[model samples]
Target: MTSKPLISVIVAVYNGAKTLQHCIDSVSNQTYLNKELIIIDGGSTDGTIEIIKSNQDKITYWESEPDNGIYHAWNKALGHASGDWICFLGSDDYLWKSSVFEEIIPHMIKAESQGTRMVYGQVARVTEDEEICCLDGDSWEYTWRGIIIDGIGSFAHQGMFHHRSIFELYGMFDVSFKIVGDYELLIRVFKEGGNAIFVNGLIVTGMQIGGITSNCVKLVNEMARARRKNRLRVITIPWLISYAWAICFPFLNYIIGERYVRYLVNFGKSSVTYLSYKKNVILEHKNDQ
Candidate 1:
């Protein structure tokens, strides 16, 4: 691999004029220079095309046309990709810092030397007001185990980089999926013996509170479908209960408010996960005894 292999950053948009410029500007300001920005707009009429046109000099390739959802646009971007590695960026998300790729590329080169094909980093989940919601930093063990056992998300696309060959080997994003396609593809990656190096700092951040994927019920359903298709067994009871809670949580929030709802939900989740882990440990110890 070259000391500075070209990286293709693919940004997909749909009526995202409001946040598109910030996303493009973040890519343009990157300290790393051997990169290309590919933008695929799903026929946005909300001035998103104008944003793309204005930034053409910073972009390598782009198109605006009617297509499927995020994953389909992702597939289109993949088709046009011409870099050694590629990553998807949401139009509503931006690199956490201008030096993100500059810091990440060296690791990619090292990983290539060590025969690793994927690399991921921490993502600071933030809200529309730029307030941090949470930080994601799961390593391969945790991500692989969590998805296989719990059907939960252990990574986000914006914070991860993939060597172009992985896609050629594992196939492109499953366009039939709208929300959990990344999760599904990741399952295949892990199952096929693919691994990632976990970069130790914040790579990207974005609004955590909205978007089509933010609908907890739909996300849960899509994830369950993905898990089933991949033949990974996961307990359905807790997820079903969570789905019910998701349906009622909005109404409950309307009454009790966002802060209280968030507090209660977080407390419940932490307590349940803690108890589950404890029980599993006990069961394993008993079997050992």
Candidate 2:
């Protein structure tokens, strides 16, 4: 990527009139110079398409007809994308900041230049009241632990920005699964041994503290599907240990959902402590200098 690489930021929207403007401005106001915004709307009846059309000039490419679901809409957006790397910013959610990609894209290019096949990043949760919280910033060392164990996390159409080749190699979002496509996609990518890199930076912020996914029951169901997909995804699990896990872990979450929440809460709390320690260390180094 010699010249500036164009980042194709795809947005999948469905009746998001309230946050539609926020989502649009978030991408449009991005400090990144070379980029394109593709929005896939699911035939919204609430004037969402009108609002999106009003700013059609700003949209690189878009379609406002009904789609199967979020991942299908995302796939449509991807098909329309014409950039070296593709990232997703959904209608319900927006980027953490206008300059996030500006700061991260160069790092991606550098990583790719280093012969890395792809990179995995992190995401934050935008609570119902609009509180922006980082998944990995607070005591959350193993942010992807849920993904590692139950096969789901804050990743979805968010938390990652990978090269076009990744989708080509692993294939696009699995439309068969509704709520678990993102988890399924990530599991496949990881199992494929894609050049994955972890960045502490905050990526997209999920805006659904009050939504279905924000709730516990729906989330567990989603996880179960994701786990099943993972088992089917990999040719075989490593030895009987993982094979047994692949069979039983999905059901374990139901018994331990409350425990899982407690663990994540503590994990998030601990991340805050670690962040403070690192910040103080940097400041101490500067003061000594």
Candidate 3:
């Protein structure tokens, strides 16, 4: 019988006392048996250390210290991870269910057989109250278009599983990118012809909203930098339009507030939906001829 592969779950946190326990519990509660948990704290002053101490028995290895950023902390954690597959979760993020790891194991096994290096699933963006906002993630087949056209990629890091060999091949995350280092690393993977598999109907993690990713302006700037760094074009129409909107979003939010901004977003989505429906109808008519 083949032994189940060991998986490592790594978390990096700073001043995350309020939510760190949930993150730890989610990993500890996983039904998968062959796994290890590692955590790196950024010298948090908010009782996060106490939480880590209490959960020491469940963690394989952990340390609390000041670090440069999430990527630096992640790079640090990578050294301690001794698993065939590695997954990263934010201090505020939690696995979607106890069966998440169990469910993903088969996919991981299949990926290994096929020489794929990455496997990812959907993530639910949730509010503090646990209300789900939406599912985030897409098929890798469609992911490249957005990465190339918008100068950004959309895979949720919390929901991704990286084969250990990927780091061995591609190196660790770039510590310089304060916001989009994960995206940059992912871009490097795809640019170098790394293969990925996306499992449908698998919701791996529940990500809390209003994290660093909510800073749209900084995210957009870093995304452009990442694209350039990876030798991807940064002058596409979608990229330009997103850059313009990101620059203006803060001012618009300041003047009109988030509610109105949400309204405008919904309106734009509606317009796009209508246009897409009309285009589909025209295509159908032409095809019928």
Candidate 4:
């Protein structure tokens, strides 16, 4: 019998004592056999270290120390990973089910056969109360356009699996990006013609909202910077409008009140969705030819 490929699940956290155990439990309880869990803690003063100590037997590797940012912790964890495939999970994120890895293994094999270095599925974006806001993720073509033209990443990074060769070829995440390092890394790979396969039937992860990625101003700024760093144009109409909206949102919320601002935001989103639908039609036609 052929051995199952090893998968390394890395979690980078800082002062996330409350949700850390749930995250660890989700990974540790995976039905898949060939997997390792690595945790990198950024010197938490909270009870996070104690939780790590408690779960030491289940964890393959763990370290607690001050770090620059999420990407820095992720980069440090990368050095310790010994898996055929790697995935990053947030302390507030958890696998959707115990059987998720078991289910995804076949897709991983398919991706490997096709020379696709990245495989991503959907993630449930949930409120703090665990009510799901929406399912996040899309096809690679849409994701590519979202990252390149819209200054946004349509997929959740938590839902992604990276082949070992991706790191070997493209290097690691850029620590310079505070809010959008994951976006920058994806942009870097896709720009260089790296292939990604989308797993349509699975929702791989459940992520709680209101993380650092929720900071609108920081996220948009870092996204624009990431596009520029990846040698992609950031002055596209969609990006310019997104930047303007991010810059004005706080003031608009304060002046017009958040309720009305949300109404305006929703209207804007509807318009963007229509535009995206139109663009997708064009892309589909091009693909058919």
Candidate that would win on lDDT: 4
Predicted candidate 2 versus true structure: per-residue lDDT over 133-163, tens digit per residue: 3353211223333344323343444656768
Residue 45 in candidate 4, Cα distance off native in Å:
1.0
Across 147-189, the per-residue lDDT of candidate 4 in tens digits comes to 7656655568999999988889889999998888889888877
Instruction: Please list the residue runs of candidate 3 whose C-alpha ends up more than 4 Å from where it truly belongs after superposition.
Output: 1-3, 251-289
Ranking by TM-score: 4, 1, 3, 2
Error of 4 at 120 (Å): 0.8
All candidates: TM-score: 0.88, 0.73, 0.87, 0.89
lDDT of 3 by residue, 1-289 (tens): 1358899999999999999999999999999889999999999999999999999999999998899999999999999999999999889999999999889899899999989888999988777888776776777755544554445444578889999998998899999999899989888888745568999899999987667866877888899899888888887655665567677778887898654553454344334334444665799899999
- Top model number, TM-score: 4
Q: Tens digits of per-residue lDDT for model 1 on 1-289? A: 9998998999989999989998899889999999999999999999999989999999999999999988999898998899998888788888888888888888899989988888888776666676765666566666555555555665667788889988988898898788889889888777645567988765554534456765767877888888788887755544555577678777877898654565555455444444555677899999999
Model 4 pairs whose backbones collide: none
Whose lDDT is higher: candidate 3's or candidate 4's? Answer: 4
Residue 156 lDDT (model 2): 43
Which should have the higher lDDT, number 1 or number 3?
3
What is the model-wide C-alpha lDDT for candidate 4? 0.83
